[model samples]
Target: MNSKVINEIKIKDGRVLTLVEGDITERNVDVIVNPANSYLQHGGGVASTIVRKEGNIIQEESDKIGFVQVGSSTITSSGILPCKSIIHTVGPRMGEGNENEKLSKAINSCLGLCLRKGFESISIPAISSGIFGFPNDKCAKILVNETISFLKNLEDSSAGIKLVEFCILGKDTLQAFQYEFEKSKPEF
Candidate 1:
């Protein structure tokens, strides 16, 4: 559990970046996550964004991996995305009692992989909170808290991850992170 709180979460000059939902194609980040099917195929939704930015290789290489279990993950090069990599993480679909656990894994995989790969910065989206149906506010609370806890546990080398952005796709999602972040702000 990373309890490290470097600073308050803000918009500009902040470590995290939140954008409008559904506009992934326009926002920029070091490495964007592709909410993919277990089969690693790129279809509609986030899949389409990856293809539009990283080229079809997003699907091709992913195909080689051939289906990840729900709540597990894999990685591939960004190819054409502004970022250096594309982490393929499978999120849970609409259901009760499954979203949080699955989201935890999805998030952990992305951060762990980036750290293992020696990346110092990364960007992510709320997992399982979109078309699959996890509520944005709930997912944001868990994701931010968990991610913060995870990062705080790392060494400086391990802690080199100074950036963990959330390119929000809508007002609700953006507000979720913002609201949660404020609650976690350090008391001066």
Candidate 2:
């Protein structure tokens, strides 16, 4: 329930990248990214948490959407949450081939959805790092780097995205993201 901004950096074109210690479901932003399975099941992990807090409308909408491919995403109403919408993205499992590329694609998909929807702010968790078994450090690094690249490459058409926050839960995950942000600070 308690959430706080741990660190942040300004990237090219005045985009803000932030690391937050909190529940992604509680983020007060335009949209929140859900690390979902291909089937859009809200059965466990962060998916279940979002359902429990936001209500079953999210699951109902996901059920209507049917299946989303790994490294892709879909959007749904946010139910009772503060945000307006949710971007449910499927991330690859750890043992799957090309895990790194898959995770990167997942992040890109979320960001792309944000751009298309004209959402200026979003909160994302460490995709595939929970029940899917991705390494915390690797997830942190990929998420940080990919987000930075996306923000930096934004042109006039994609400039609506002003804020991106990694709303991490566990201490270790938060620390990993913090480390990545700190390491990337000088480059931006």
Candidate 3:
């Protein structure tokens, strides 16, 4: 729960892009995206932290969904966390095929799933930038770009998402996302 706001961008549709230096497990958004393995295993990095805080039930439900393809995602009810649900997404490893494209697809898929579930707000970490070894700056650029693109495509406020947060961990990741957000935000 030690998260503090680092930065924020208000999109044209009234939605927000937030950058926070904190633990996603403590975020109170409607959903929190977990960067998980295709097997839905919560064994390391942010995934492990989430499982440690939320308990085994998150993994139990994920196990039912079994395996998810890289760049794809699925959802499960939050076990003990404050959020209502968790969206587990499989992110690509560093040397995986077309790492950048796979990472972008993974984030877009997570956001798409959240919208379909009617979630108005979600907190996401820097997927694949941790144990998956994707570079923080590259991760920042792709994630922030895809997020802005997704929000800009919303036809109206009723698209169901009003907030998308990059609940990043580590000072380096936080800075990376912050820089990307600043660089991409519209000149107003």
**Per-model lDDT:** 0.69, 0.93, 0.91
**What are the per-residue Cα lDDT tens digits for candidate 3 across 52-164?**
98888998998889989999999999998999999998989999779999999999999999999999999999999988999999999999999998988888776689999
Whose TM-score is higher: candidate 1's or candidate 3's? 3
What C-alpha lDDT does candidate 3 achieve relative to the native structure?
A: 0.91
Question: TM-score order of candidates, best first?
Answer: 3, 2, 1
Candidate 2 accuracy as TM-score: 0.97
Tell me the deviation in Å of residue 86 in model 1: 0.3
Model 1 backbone overlap count: 11
Better-scoring candidate (lDDT), 1 or 3 = 3
- TM-scores of the models, in the given order? 0.82, 0.97, 0.97
Better of 1 and 2 by lDDT: 2
Question: Model 1, 126: alpha-carbon shift in Å?
Answer: 1.7
**Best model number under lDDT:** 2
Instruction: Output the better candidate (2/3) by lDDT.
Output: 2
